[model samples]
Target chain A: MSTAAIAALTAILLVGIASTVIGIVGHRARRTSDFLVASRNVGAGANAGAISGEYLSAASFLGIAGLVLSDGVDALWYPVGFTAGYLSLLLFVAAPLRRSGAYTVPDFAEVRLRSRGLRLVCTAFVLVIGWLYLLPQLQGAGLTVATVTGLPAWTGELGAGIVIVLSVMFGGMRSATFVQAFQYWLKLTAVTLPVIVALVYFLGSGHTYDRPAPPSFPERTTVDVHTGVTLQAGQDVTFTAAGRIDGRDVAPTEPQTWTAGSRHVVGEGTDLTFPAGSAVPVVAGGPVADDEWLLPLSGADPHQLLGIYSLIIATFLGTMGLPHVLVRFYTNPDGRAARRSAVYVLAMIGVFYLLVTLLGALSRFYTPQLLVGGQTDAAVLLLPTAVLGSGTAGAVLGGIVAAGAWAAFLSTSSGLVVSLAGVLSTDVLRGKRLSNFRFATVLAGAAPVALALGVTQLDFTETVALAFAVAASTFCPLLVLGVWWRGLTAKGAIAGVLAGGILAAGAVGVSLAGIAGTGVLGVLLYRPAIVSVPVAFATMIVVSVLTARERPTDVDAVMLRLHAPERLGLSRDAVSGRDRAELDEPAPDERAAGPA
Target chain B: MSTIEERRADTGTVYERVQAGPEFADLRRRLRRFVFPMSAAFLVWYLAYVLLASYAPEFMATKVAGNINVGIVVGLLQFVSTFAITTVYVRFANRHIDPAAERIRQQIEGPAR
Candidate 1:
């Protein structure tokens, strides 16, 4: 039939295939370990693939393309921060957290701090991060589907939410692992194949690429583009069909034609436009400009130094706190295996990022027309179609890309839903049955779906970044201190986590409530990580020092477990909670057990 | 849950039939040395990527592909390098580390020949 029908069928078929695959794998691997950590038996290749799958979410694949297409060079930070964040995961948190043998972040908190209260606090952070991260993925799905099929945006998002929830409910982590790993290759193939084919098509077409035109009014003689522009978010703005400028009709058809400093004056009542090729500078108002919320602090003003750095810190520090991401480490056989897994994940994440940048840049160059609707989310598909010609080959390539996008979202979302369910069941509904855990999964999945549905009005990037900031502020510091320092007390952890999480989440809530966007409150409210991370770190350290009496005596044992890989094998089975305390210090039991 | 606990306790009796073998401690020491430093180095390398990405964006944005750019190259390579590292890690672990750890564990806890 039509393009919309083709796109719709492609989206549904991809999700269906993915869900079926996960269900089959998850059903076969049905065990606690499989459900939670993939049986701690995942191989390097598979784990690497799964890591790629989990890592390349809508943000990486779609958001980066949009950013790069919309803004030159500066948008590179998204991929950089995203890929590099894993490095932070490798160094400060990986091995030690893994060595603790905890299945989730809250589990680590409990083991490190020896307090159930701390576990609950960490559990809260995990849920927050999961939901925050979930929102963007959902929003992204909406944008992608709506662009591809001309369907209502919510239709795509809600459908995605349902599929992801079903996948998680059916398979849990074990299945998600296989699905994610498989999806990575699928994603790579989808993105790269299209790029290669499209490149060939463009070159084969015999058109010498034109140099970008001078920034000015579009050539008045070119096809009139004066139709009222409708933003994907459903906002509208009117523009003159053609403007008479310098003795000819100038229509702003191509961005490449814009000069460095050209400006456009809309009609008396109309708004403004950058020169055709000028940075699509996101002004403070209008549909596109609203991403200022995403930028948070224009710390460098036209430069975004603080906002960029804040994002960097968030992604770098934030990875440690991501529950689903962290839970994957536990599936490795031991602490050393966990560390190796992190390294592998980092490498895989890095490679896919290169492709993401290409896609982003190509969208602006090849599909500048789509930029009007901020169709960067659909660039991977649109660019290929534009280059390959709207034919069967293009449709096939588009379908493959669509499948990758679905897989990326489904895998990560399933992972999140599973982890959220696990934590909530164990920590919130302690002593609950398996059914209760499943119920938690439904609850956890549904909340984000509701939030995603409600907040369809906001910019996708900003919602996602707020999630990252909260993750960075609340859980990142908690994990860093919990793993590295001996002085991290249960009371301290509880206090620090609550303080950091509350402050950050509160700031986000206040900002979302339409408070004035001017001074100190705005900065703190918008970019809470700069404020919250340090506060969490300081609070943990200070509180721990004050509450040393409650400290575990096995500091030395814990250190050995964390650092010494020698006695790490089966002896770990001998290590008890009390032994952990003894490891941390010269306990009375050290004398009782005598020398090894 | 109780049955699983009981079965686990029954399994504990088997530990008595096993004895630590002569090669166990030495193998443990060797495996520990190999795995620890290798893992530590990779961890350091991984951390360096993050530090570079976070603190050094300007350097990253330099080009590698036509316009693909170094930042993009480095970012994508992160995923590739991680897999390569992981494959090597697993090969090393299976060949050098796991067999040793298993040998040591079996000597201490597995039934004796």
Candidate 2:
């Protein structure tokens, strides 16, 4: 095995061991009163770490750098939108959500609306969003494992799926706080250390990207084609090929020429070697010149402005709507602690994304070969070996990065699995028994692995963004309206959530089916938030106004519950859905455990 | 777990009365004064930044100092604005929102604690 692969494998194993050891050591969710105040009484800072850990996921860790490499400055908005999401959460959702005393998103729906139907609908969306989000993470794991270990993608998916099921069943309900908080620091170090090293090395090397041509090979380079790519060259490139090129195979001894402005199809598993100074030929969609790449809106074709706006709306509003994200807020002890945790989260994730952005810019100099194969998602994974020359130190750094990527997948999938299990055990299965949660974890973890195994063409970050878009359309309206508006009724929420969910999911379906055509309409469909989000809010408001008589007479009481400060002695004890049945009421004394 | 008298004793009017009172009014107004305008302002600021990056590539690409382009600096300022807003709001909450809310809490919890 290559040293890079061996180091990466070892690093992944070590992270797994450390996470398990910490989780076992920190199992303290033991007493009822401790949890009557909150789960584990998780401090604001530690809860912030856990929130950032789960929130970062595959999209932030690997997808941000990939997008920046492929699309340039405009793509930096993904991370920006990601961090700014917390602002809305802080301003509006955080304190109110924590104060609502609901166990899950579905629980919040029931508590606010007093309708089982609304709760069920919210449960449906949570499952859809959770599975949609889970699939891409598993697919990303497959991609990284295939790149580093050269194993088939299914093994990665299967292996990750099993690890998540076992760990979540054993550690998730017991010691989740310690494991998730540790992961955030591990992920930060994983991305930051390599970034600092590469920065020093790159400055001394004096490489510049302002030239008129595409980035060139600094040395003789060979790129492995894991997926078929159509190379679009702006300048002439000559190479020796060992696999199918335009349906014609030549041995490694044969030299090939790809003339400028011409397209050549390189089949999967082909290895092409480029001589030094050979201009890089980008894949079909990306810009081939450094000049085109360094500017904004150059890489995205058709409707660049509309696309950017749609992406902006999805990420900024979609953040608080994510099911996993909302559950993290519930871990905070009180409404005040929830708000404080959000601020800490903003700083933590913001710092991490800045380092991610720097690495993406650096990948232009170090791992330019990724542009050729259209596998830029590997940019962060392959960067250390590329910059530091694949030696012992480089291999160790590569291992750390690979391990970090595994950590991203592991932490995120477990969070999703635990969430899905919460909903399933309480609402779908027998009841909220420990055995039911364990059984549901296996189901939740397996379904996505099964889907990821069948789906091969998934783009790592864009798929996650699609899930975010759906969440933005559905729950962004529900929560924002539910918290701030008293006119919202069960009928209104159901209609609005259904309308938004269907429209958003339809847009995703059309785009994934490759029929979202190349026109203004296509841009609208591919990035639908600019259109769907307004429709959702409008539907909720209109339907809500029409059904105002159906509004729960207890609206003021619920609003007071959501908005009142914790010191007011009004809020009920938070019931974690992991162990408690959804409709089961907390004992009156526990509810009256109010101010004291 | 619930009976008609227990439901009657639910004391729903107390919450309604408290929610209707002047201190609660001040509390709600205080929170809205900070959050609504601040949320709108930051969202508008972020939207403006996004729109500029989309519409005006040349302006974004203009260099400022030492290879740092206007685009990157503006991007970094998004970070700055986010952090700055967080700091400002935390201060606002500690000084303005929390104190008034605390006053109301003491009134509501009188002899109840």
Best by DockQ: 2
The interface RMSD for candidate 2 is: 3.5
Query: Which stretches of candidate 2 lie above 4 Å from their native place?
Result: A24-40, A240-256, A262-271, A513-516, A574-596, B1-10, B111-113
Q: Which candidate is the best by TM-score?
A: 2
* Per-residue lDDT value at A211 in model 2: 59
Best lDDT among the predictions, by candidate number: 2
User: Native contact fraction of candidate 2?
Assistant: 0.55
**What TM-score does each of the candidates earn?**
0.74, 0.92
Please give the DockQ score of every candidate, comma-separated: 0.11, 0.49
Per-candidate local distance difference test: 0.61, 0.79
Worst 10 residues of 2 chain A by lDDT: A29-38
Model 1: fraction of native contacts: 0.12
Each model's Cα RMSD: 9.6, 3.5
